[model samples]
Target chain A: MARIDLVDLAHSYDGGNADPSSFALKPTSMTWRQGGAYALLGPSGCGKTTLLNIISGIVKPSRGKVLFDGRDVMALTTQQRNIAQVFQFPVIYDTMTVGENLAFPLKNRGVGRAEIDARVHEIAKLLDLVPQLDRKASRLTADAKQKISLGRGLVRADVAAVLFDEPLTVIDPALKWELRSKLKVLHRALDLTMIYVTHDQTEALTFADTVVVMHEGSVVQTGTPEELFLRPDHTFVGYFIGSPGMNVLPAEVEGRQARIAGHELSLARSYGGLPPGARIEVGIRPEFVSLAAAAPGLLAARIERIDDLGRSRFAHVRVGDLKIAARVPRGLSLGGNEAGLIFEPAHIHVYADQRRVEGAA
Target chain B: MEKIPNQKAWLLVLPVFAIVAFSAVIPLMTVVNYSVQDTFGNNKFFWNGVGWYQELLDPSTELGGRFFASLWRNLAFSGAVLAIQIPLGIIVALAMPREGWGVAFSLVVLALPLLIPWNVVGTIWQIFGRSDIGLMGWGLNRLGFDYNYVANPIDAWLTIIIMDVWHWSSLVALLCYAGLKSIPEAYYQAASIDGASRWAVFTAIQLPKMRHVLVIAILLRFMDSFMIYTEPFVVTGGGPGNSTTFLSIELVKLALGQFDLGKAAAMSIVYMLIIIIVCWVFFTVMTNAGADRKGAGGER
Candidate 1:
């Protein structure tokens, strides 16, 4: 296993002359620890694939070096880098049997026949594919074929890392869960550094120990799933992660309090001398905010709708012209549209220019 | 939903039925009619049931001897053409540029030979093979070879075989190119990441993916070369003492050249049956080979 490092790596499909905003991936440096499960999460065309390709040595970056285990590998081809990639669709050799497909990488590297057989058997057993080892890979279902793809990547013992490019896209929905958990189990058992690229939040959050969220050609945040949910470093992260997302409202902030639609709210920390004329806002998760009957001590809002999501209920409320979502406590009933929103002071984060701003305590 | 058996749906096929009758049935019926009857100068046809067939099948007779010789010649010609064209076509397809303006440029150039009329191709090669004037023939003769297609049977055969390969391999190449194009970019990326060698990728990925197109290429080249007449007829005219005469040329010489309708009709019927049976067998074998892997182990 190797720790992959990107030193100021970036890519522009139009070559280096393109504007910064047009780049497929922006200049950034990060390090992936050895044997860590990392996910590059982003929407389509958000440069997650571009970053993965750079790591796998498939696409050379316009700037910066890629270091593997403290060695510069910028000039290496994908094969020379010795990384394994599982594609979004299963790419099995149609003419080969399952055992042969699993043994392909080993055979390509000129491993001993006995060793190849042993590795293939080990991977097949781990993947529960032993029964179909002799069957033609082309005749299997998509999920089974994807399992073979995974097995091929894992069969090689000396791979630097295994990269997955949304490998479960073609699988049946019911099988995605099984294959996902299987991947987690494989990671723990094999102790391989794996990078999973996907746009699905649940897939990234559940599969990766560290999730890197990218938006519009750059990384917005990189942290643990709980860290991302609890404290988003960028406004985009706060908006992209949570269900119904963290509610963001245009507000005015002073030393110890904030004003949203002319109502004052207390802050746990002090914000002194905020940047002149910055577009300031407040962000808080729905789980940290709740609704109560209109009271003098709370910020007044009109409840627009209530969503009952089996486990909990969330109230979509409007304070003046700004829409906000807050939790509806169990057994709490509202007789009319009027209600008040209670925000947890510690969970309220401030933003200026879409980047999170820390306040002085 | 309840199923309804509609008889009127059969009437909806009337146009197709009429079209097939006019295009295929009526003309084939004429050949069958002539095969069974003997016709004289006054258009007087006498019943001559299977006499022509018996004479044609019996090798002791002139017609049978001629038929067998031309049949063997046709088979050999087809076999050589396929053996040469399929591999050559695949190589050419692989060499083709994958992107940018070069793709369109190469495709158009490759299709030029296929666009030429068969007779034109024959005439071009016929003149192009003349020892005294043509560039190829003069060049070979200068290189100290007596390369005259007119007098030498071997030279005549070589010229026709080379000419056919030049004119038809592009069709196979184009089909293979299309098959290669349909493979996703991900497959190549995955292969590279797996550290596959170039030849291994060709054998394990390219060849298997090109199987369907190769089948088409083989069948087309086989039938087209087996029934070949125009190009070789124009170039050789079945010359050098009938050494290069194929089945089609011989059949045409029998019916139109010597006015032997009954024997020609019998040969034509047999020829049609041969083409049908061969193509049917070929298609079945190809499809079966592809699907055999699924035997009792179909999709989960």
Candidate 2:
């Protein structure tokens, strides 16, 4: 396995140097470590597939160098790079039996017959496809075909890496979890570097040790799932990672004090000499916002609606013109139309110009 | 509770039944009637029973020998056409442009011959194969090959085969091209990533996916070539001592040229049965091969 490095990579579909609006993938640099399970997470058209293709050498980047283990591989074809890619749709030779499908890559590389047979059998057993080894691949269910796709990649022992581009999209919902866990088991058992591209946050968070979140053709944050959940690097990350997302309120900041809707609030960190025209906001997760009795620094809001969510409840409240969602524990009784909302000091984050400010405790 | 059968569905099907009766059954019955009896010019018919059928089946008789010879010729012509056209068509289809303005232009050009009527195609080839005025014949003669389709049996056969190829190869090519286009880009991409060579990709992916279309092309070409008449009739009139006389030409010569009604009727029935049996065999073999590959899932 080899570590993949993308240096100043960018892609424009129109064949000209692209402006921000036209570029399919914005210029950026990142490195994927060997034997690491990583996910490129984003919505549709967010360039996750483009980035995956670039890494796999399927698409030549318009401007960049791709290095495999510090060796420049920009001129190498996909075959020369020796990377295996599984597509969104399962692609198998319909005429071939499952055994032959798994053996195809090895055979293409001119591996010996006995070795090819051995590898095919090993992979088939790992995928629980031993019984289907003699059956034609065209006759299988979609998930089974996808398993053959995965098996073909795994059958090659000398591949640099295995890349998946939304490979679970065609699988049934109940089978998705089983295949996902099977992927994780294979990754651990084989110790191959795997890069999965998907638009589903749950798939990314559960599958990858390090998840890279992209928004609008650029990466917004790359971190462990816990870090992303706790401290999002950009406002998009905060709004994208959680169920109800974070509540952001417009604010004006000066030195150690911030004012929101004419109420002065104490700051967790100092913002000395802030830019003159920079828009500022306070971001807090709904889970961290608490309901409290009247207290100093607590903001009063009118509770518009309360939704019971079995183990917890969501209190939709309005403070002046701003709407906020606060997740409160079940059985917490509150009678009035108005309640004091308290922001947990350690959980509160500040953003300036849509990026998290540094020194926010 | 026992449910009453709905008999009114027959009324709904009556129109189709009437159409088939008028179009197929009545004419076939007339042929059968002619096959079993002897008829003169004044509507006087006498029972012939199986006399004409026995005469047609007996190889010692002149008509039986001619029928067998013509049948063999028809089979050979169809076999040669299929052997040449199927591979040539696939190659042409593969060479066709995949996208952009070139695709539309190439498709229209390839489809030009198919849009022409059968008589027009015959007349065009008839004039085009003449030694005095035709390009191919004049060019070959100028090159010192002594080519004349009217006088030489081999030259006449060659001219007819070439004309048939030119007229119908495009149909096969168009069908194959459609099949090739339906393949997803992902299959090729995956093949490339697997380090498959060009020939491997063709055999493994392209050929397997085009199997159904190829079956259709084969069946159409086989039936059409076996019953071919107009072009050869126009070009050579089954000339050079009946060297190129196929089953259809021989049947027409019997029915219309000589007015031998009973023998012609028997030959027509035999010809129809042969076409049906051959087509059924081809369809069954190809479909069974496909089903074997696709029936594995049902086995579970």
Candidate 3:
């Protein structure tokens, strides 16, 4: 295993650099530390799979250099790179038994019989495929076949890295969690650097040490799960990473003071030298907002709707044509249409042009 | 209390029954009738009982020996065609263009031979194999080989086999192409990631997935080759000491040339029975193989 560095990588399916719309992946650079579980997370058509394919040597980037342990591998084929990848759909040799399927990579590499057998058996045991080792892969259930797909990758010890492209998509819902936990355990036990590509936020957050969130062919943010939740680098990350995402409202900023919907508010940080002509906004998660009984230092608003989520309630309120959501604790006795909505200074974040304003949290 | 059953469902099957009886059963009954009875001049009938069948089945009798010889010939021809065509078809299918306008162009080119009528195919090869003016015959003669299909039995057999291969191999290739197209791209991607060679990919992914289509192609080629008469009859007329006389040609000769209706009818029935039984056996074996693989219940 080795650390992977992507140097100014960009890809265009049409092979043209003039039209940005044709670019599948925008130019960007990042590093994945060795033995670290990193997730490339995004919605569909967000370049996550493109990034994974470029790293796996399946698709050469239009212009970039991929360095594995600082050695450029752009010209190497997938076989030459020796990376193992599991696809969205399980791919196993239908004619081969589970044991043979797991031993395929090693056999291709011309490993000895005894060593291949040992590695196959070890991986089979780890994947809970010991009982079905003698059975043909075509006869197995979808989840079991997926396990074999994973096992084949794990059986080869000389692989540079293991890549997963939505490998759990075909798995049953109840079995998804079980398989995900098993993947986590395998990553830990094998100490292999793995890059998992998925669109599901829960899967990315739960599986990766660092989650790279992409939007519109560009990397929007890359941070730990806690860091992403607490401080999003971009507005897309703030909205994409959380359910009932952070509420953004247009605001005017002057030094340590901000004005929103004709209500003056005190800022926790100053944006003294703001960029000219940049749009200013205030962002706050619903969990940090609270309803109050008409008090100073709070904005007056009309409650539009309340969704009771058993443990907590989401109160969607309107303040001067702007809708803001507030998560209220249970038994708060919120009944009236008119109430005061308070934004916690510590949790409120200021953004200029969709990017987080430095020192303006 | 017993409920009244809906009797209307029976009427829905009436049209199918009528069609089957009219098209198949009636013609088959006429053949069966002819098999058990003898006819003299002006339709004067005599009770033949099992005499014709017994004579045709006994190897000591001339009729029986001819029937068995032609039967063996038919089987060998079918076996050779299947053995050669199936693999050749798969290779052609693999080599066909996969996508874009080239795919359409290749498909049209590949389908050209299959679209030719069987009789026309025979006629084309018949002239094409002439030593004087035909390309293949003149080419072979020029290469210092005395290749005369009309006068030589071995040459006739070779010509017929090659003619049949050219006429039907495209059907098998098209079926295999359809099978290949049905496979998802993920399988190929995974195979590449697994470091599988081209041969391994074919054996593991392409071959296994093409099993159902291959079975269909085998059955079709077997049946067509076994009953083959028109092409070979038009080309060689079962010449050169009856070496190329297959079962259908021999049956036609017995009924039409020699006016042995009873014996021809019996042979026809036997041929039909053999084809049915062999096809049934093939279908059963293939379907059972499919079930056995999936029946192991690897889920648990």
Candidate 4:
């Protein structure tokens, strides 16, 4: 296992002369500790896959150094780098049985036949593929095929890391959870550095120890699931992590007060020296904001709709022209369309130009 | 749900039957009729029974000797053609550009030979292999090798084989190229990540992926080479010593050259049966091998 470092890594499918803004992967630097489970989370064309490919050495970055264990590996091919990658679709040798598929990496590396067999069986057992050891990999279900793909990745003991490029995309819905948890289990048992690239938040949130949220080719935030939900560094992170997402509204900010739609909300922290002419906004999670009966101090809103999500209800409220999501308190009777929103002072975050501002508490 | 028996469904299949009857069945029947009868120049025929078949099957008889010799020649020719073409085609396919403007240029150039008419291919090679006028023959002789396709049997065989390979190797290559194109980029990436070498990638991934197409290429090449008559016949006209007389050439000689209608019809029928049977056996074996693996996996 190796700690992977991306030292100002950047890439553009077009050559070096291309404009910096058009790069598929914008300049970024981050380090992943050995044996850490990390997920690169982003929507399609957000450069997550490009980043993953760069890590795996499938695509060479146009700039920057990739260091493994503090050694620059720019000239190393993927095989020389000793990384394993499972693709979005299951990629197994159709002519080979599951056992042979698992043994492929070892065999290619000229590992002893006995050791290859042992490793194959061990990986197969871990993947619950012992019964399918001799069966053709091509004829297996998509989930099983993905499992075989995973098994192949895990068979080699000396691999620096195993990279997954949305490996569970083709799995059945019911099987996705099973395979996902299986991956989590494998990560624990094998103690290999696993970097999973996916757009699905649940997959990222559940599988990763630290989730790196990306937007438009740049990493917006890198934090644990709770941290991402509680304190998103960027507006994209806040809007992407939570179910209803953090409700962001165009606002005017001064000191600890944020005025939205001509109404004021107090802040727990004092904000000073705000960037001039920046697009200022206030973000609050729906879980923190509560719907109440129209009160004098509360911000007035028109309840557009209430979504009953079993454990809780969120009222989609319109405050002036701005729409906001506020939690509907249990055991409260609503008499009319008009309601008031109470934004929890501690939960409110100030943003300028789509990036969170750190205020003095 | 109750079943509805509609007899009109069979009527929908009438066009297929009519087409098959006119295109295949009636012509085949005419051959079958001719195979069992003796016919003269006047078209007056008499039942010859299996007398012609018996003579054709017995190697001691003149008809049997000629048939066996030509059949062996056809088999050898097909074997040689397959042995050379399959690997050459695969190599060419591999060497082809995977992308860019070069891909279009390569594809067009590769298809040029296959687009030529069979007789035209024959004529081109016939002159091309001439010691007096052709570049290849003139060049070879000038380089101190006595090469004359018109006079030497080995030279004649080599020329025809080379001609056949040139004319048809592109078809196999094109088919293999198509097979290679269908493989997702992920497979190669996965193989590379697996630490597979070039040979390992070819054997473990590419070769297996191209199995279906390779089977088609082999079958087509085998059938076409086995029944080949046009090119070699044009080039050598069965040669100075009947050296290039393949089965089709022999059959044509018997039917048109010698006017032996009974023997030629029987020979053509036998040739058709051999092709059908060989193709059936080959197809069955390949498909079953694929099926066996699927069956062994068992459903989830």
lDDT of each: 0.92, 0.88, 0.90, 0.92
* Clash count in backbone of candidate 4: 0
Each model's TM-score, in the order given? Answer: 0.97, 0.94, 0.96, 0.97
- Using lDDT as the measure, name the better of candidate 1 and candidate 3: 1
Range of the 10 consecutive residues with the lowest summed lDDT in candidate 1 chain B: B291-300
- Which residue pairs show backbone clashes in model 1? none
Q: Which candidate would rank higher by DockQ, 1 or 2? A: 1
Candidate scoring better on DockQ of 2 and 4: 4
Model 2: per-residue Cα lDDT over A172-265, one tens digit each:
8898898898889989988899999998888999899999999888899999999999999888898888877888889988766778788777
Q: Comparing 2 and 3 by lDDT, which wins?
A: 3
Clashing pairs in model 2, backbone N/Cα/C closer than 3 A = none
What does candidate 3's lDDT look like per residue over A171-261, in tens digits?
8889888888888998999899989999998999999999999999999999999888888888888888887788888999888788999
Off by over 4 Å in 1: B1-11, B292-300
Interface DockQ of each model: 0.60, 0.53, 0.60, 0.57
Candidate 3 residue-wise lDDT, B1-300, digit = tens: 999999998899998999999999999999999999999769887899998999999988999999999999999999999999999999999999889998999899889998999899999999999999999999999999999999999899999999999999999999999999999988888888888999999999999999999999999999999999999998999887899999999999999999999999999999999999999999999999898766756432
lDDT score at residue A325, model 2, on the 0-100 scale: 91
**Predictions in order: chain A TM-score:** 0.98, 0.94, 0.96, 0.98
Residue range B1-300, candidate 2, lDDT tens digits? 999999999999999999999999999999999998988768889999998889888888999999998998889899989999999999999999999999999899999999988778878877887889988888888889999989999998888888888999999999999999999988998998999999999999999999999999999999999999888888888888899999989999999999989999999888999999999999999999888666645221
Quote the chain B TM-score of every prediction. Answer: 0.94, 0.95, 0.95, 0.95
lDDT digits (tens) for residues A1-361 of candidate 1: 8988999988999998799889999998999998999999888999999999998988988989899999999989999998999988889899899999999988888999999988899899989999999988988877889899999988887778989999989887888888898889989888899999999999999999999999988999999999999999988898889887999989999988999889899998898867888999999999999999899989999999999999999999998889999999999998999999999999999999888888899
**True lDDT of residue A295, candidate 4:** 88
